[model samples]
Target: MKKRGWLYFLIFAFILGYTYTALVYNGIWFKFTDGLKTIHFLLYFVWFFVAFFLSLTLHELGHFFAFLFQGIKLRALYITVFVFHKTNKGWRFTIKPKLWVLLGGLVVPDLGEIKSDEDLEKVHKKFANSLVVAPIVTCVFLFIVILTFILSLIYSRSDNWIGFISIFTIYTILLSSLYIYSFTLSNPMFYGDFVAYKKMKEDPVFQLAQISQYTMFSLEDSDETNTYLWEKTRDTLKTIPLKNSIFHIMLLTNYLDGIIRSDQEIDLQIDKKIQHLSISHYMRNEQGLMLAYDLCYYHYKQKNVAKAYQLFDEIQRRVSKKLDPKLTTYYKKKSMHIMHIEYQDEFLEQIDNYYVGNSWIFESLMDPYETLKEYHEKLPFIEYSLPVKFEEETWCFQKSMLYHTKR
Candidate 1:
């Protein structure tokens, strides 16, 4: 569409980079992560999410401009950017003139238009244009805004108006530019919007999908469960897409199948692509969807006791309230169920005690398959802990977590 392959290039590069590094590190998770001095790199990972949010804001702002250009109205423009903190209840990034803070992943882009299905059809096409052009324009404008603001600050005038204006413009542009850069990588994961542009123009199924993609809580209508786009409804533009249109649900379903069913034959690129994609609000929710279940299951199967416990805690907050009913039963009724860390901690404590006393525990933990198998054999089989040793320090993790295994 935009020949904007460069925008996504970095996503691919990072995916390959992260996957390679993870494989190398998996071979030596304890050694690499716990190595001499990686404070800088680890910090970079944490801060990288900030850049991600900024890019998202810029992308959506582009959509806002696109809608305006086509004479469609915007009811709301939510910029879901937030700094990571334990207690903040509002938008994390704020304008000095009027700032706001939020917990992570709260920036929701909501666009509203006139009350007519016909209007929605017209606006839908405009949205496709905005999806492609707006982000590009937003990036160019932001870069200039940030650059001008940088130059503006050099020539300070006590004419308070000049200084204030310069600072205001600088913050907005800098924030936006940082965001645009994040999306403007060489290998993008969410090239579907670009793909959708060509495909949706002809396929009304894709066009109707745009609506359902964002609105998941509500149904298509009171009568039909798997409803396609409803023609008579006044606010039909915002109607939720079918389950088939739910990107996160589909991708996650596939990912879970990979680790649970032991489909190692499936390439990591196919499984983890969701993490790299930069796209619609619906898709972002799919990011990191399979972290907990995969790791816990794998470690238990391998009989590693310690690593599984920590992984459970790390990913517990993302607990899904619902799942495919069969999977819910399969995961829950499994021989080694560590789904609820809170319920099984006392038992895991006893297992941790056994490892601490056993010096050859290192050798025991090294046997990944044996590690999982033994843990599964244990009563009430909790998350098997794999206490990995790197030099002097001891770190715990599960076998299924998948890191680079360096020789």
Candidate 2:
């Protein structure tokens, strides 16, 4: 286990022990028949649950509205229970929610669309404000609750309401403290917003972030050729250390793309680096989908048909389950693309006969070499000299043909 894992385990054990001792001391451990005690317990449980839900909701809204107030357009706002979005057509809501999304809403700004120095500065300011606003709003609301609780104690003649308010106030304050910790504490699984903001303030870090966003946009957009994006990704990875799983996975994606395009040979060193990284700690479901595709491709290339088929089957099973339809479609399309490359003639014949109605199947069947030459003729194909055992392998079949034909 990593240091973070150990720390979390110890904390859990401590909490469990403390809770057990407290329940025993209060004579409430396994005493379900005590009606009065049960009522009090139920009331406090309901109050704390409500307080936590409200606190978390307000905390996320703090970040969401902060971004809007700073003139930043959020692509999506997630509050754990649902994802809210403003699309080109109109607003949309989705029920898919993640724990990280609920703890502090993710504010994805159009950072790649920044075109000027002024725009960059505005974004940096807005990003920083968004990070700080959640904790700030949470603290302010907690203070208000605390003050109200105190006032009720001093001025209220009704003891019952005051007691309930006091407990509610305490729970709210505890929830706020957790909210602050979620963003400030360093964990192997997720970085706090404050930490991310601080890293973004650095020039190299900011440049890498910008480049990553651009790379993703190029990959997902309608543009066919990612030659420029591939080059930018390669150059940026050289300068940035693979300190985090996000960057590491970005590099892996670039590497996988290069291999698929036949622009670079598989590097064992790069593969070794990825193997060493803790991918599960940082990878989301979408990223996992991409990783699965890459692994399927890799296994196929290495002549491990069983493993490749297993991976593909797993992906298909996941698609049949409750995954987002859009995401499932994407994974299926990409997986088919990989299979098309590995089993060119077989896949082509299968698709040609069985999937004639599928537009995506037809699109994926287009000759990659022709597609690359058409969109990116000016860009030179990158050649990597691998170790002696991996000699004679090259990427970009069309680029190689064009080069030799020109010579």
Candidate 3:
């Protein structure tokens, strides 16, 4: 574990230990043995949870409103697994629950459409405000709680003292948690509000990395964008530290730009470089997924059928268990059949369905789907053996190194 992770763990463990000692050793558990006592305990327990979720919701809304005020378009807002995103069709709701998301909620802004350094900087400032706003809201809530506690002490009647005390005690705990949350999430490991704010303010490399990723996802891979994006990404790559996880993204974008521009001198070993980074300890799951998506295509284009199928199978296994596989996984069986002409019709049909079905999602897949169509139109006759279906004994072991290696 990272040092920050250990500190967080110890903090939590200490809180739990102290709570346990209070309940069991200090006679608090015995005091709650009767019916009224049990009901009082239950009331406080329920109130604690209710207050906790309510505060979290307000914190995220602070980001949502901040984006609105900053004139930054909202991509999606997430509260645990549930997501609400803007689409051409309309706003839509979907569940995208993951282990990490269960801890907090956040709003995702539409920064994908950046076209130049000016656009990037404008979005960066707006995005920084969104991050800062959430923590400010949390602090405000803590301040309100402290004020309420002080007011209760001064104004409450003797008969109402117990009720005021109970409420204050719960709020006090929530306020303490909010403080801890602000401090803990500020660690870069969480990539939470403070970390994002710090990175945006202090690191030019991080700023350029953000643009590089958004450009790859949003920009059309035509002559207009290829040259400009390639130059920017190359400059970013030159300066980014090797240990940064986004260094892989810069490399991938550079490689993609080269392909789009038809650069004959482009390094053919780009996939190998990405594969090396995908196995690193710092690689994130989403990054691994993006790398796997590209690697499958690269290996297939290279006539390395076995490796392509292996990559595709891993993606398939991950997506199969998802509640909404279409939104999460790009390549279905039909999409995978694009390489072979036999399933060309099915592939085209599936692509149409995917576009129509996912029109409400935040990110657009039009460019990628069009690219697939173009490939289908011009793929020449080439003899190649069919790939075997991949089978791995352990799901954990078979997971992308990016997923398994994150600290």
Full ranking by TM-score: 3, 2, 1
- For candidate 1, report its TM-score: 0.31
Writing each residue's lDDT as its tens digit, candidate 2 over 1-407 gives 69999999999999999988976776544342232232476798889878977887788788878877877655666565556665566667766433433344454454344434464566666677777787788888999999887566546655566667767887897877776776676553366767766755664444444444533322134232344445445555555555545455655566666765455655565555544544333334555556656666665665555666666776675533444565555446545554542222343333323222112211211333333233221122222233565335454676799899999
lDDT string, candidate 1, 1-407, tens digits: 45568768878999989976874765432332232233344544444554555555666666666766776544334454222211123323332211233221221223333244575577567767766775576567666756654454344333343434343454556666554554444232343345656545665545554544333222122223222233222122123332323443433343343344533333334324423432222312222333334545545444554655545544434445453343333333332334333344344334432322122212211333344334433323444344775743233343333354531
Model 2 CA deviation exceeding 4 Å by range:
1-41, 94-105, 110-112, 116-121, 210-235, 241-244, 251-407
**Top model number, TM-score:** 3
Score candidate 3 by lDDT: 0.57
Better of 2 and 3 by TM-score: 3
Residue pair clashes in candidate 3: none
Clashes of each: 50, 2, 0
- 297-392, model 3: which lDDT tens digit per residue? 555556676776676666666543423454343344443555452454654556644432332332332345665445333223346675676667
Q: Which portions of model 3 miss their true places by more than 4 Å?
A: 1-39, 81-83, 89-101, 158-165, 168-172, 175-179, 182-189, 209-231, 238-247, 250-286, 289-407
lDDT comparison, 1 vs 2, better candidate? 2
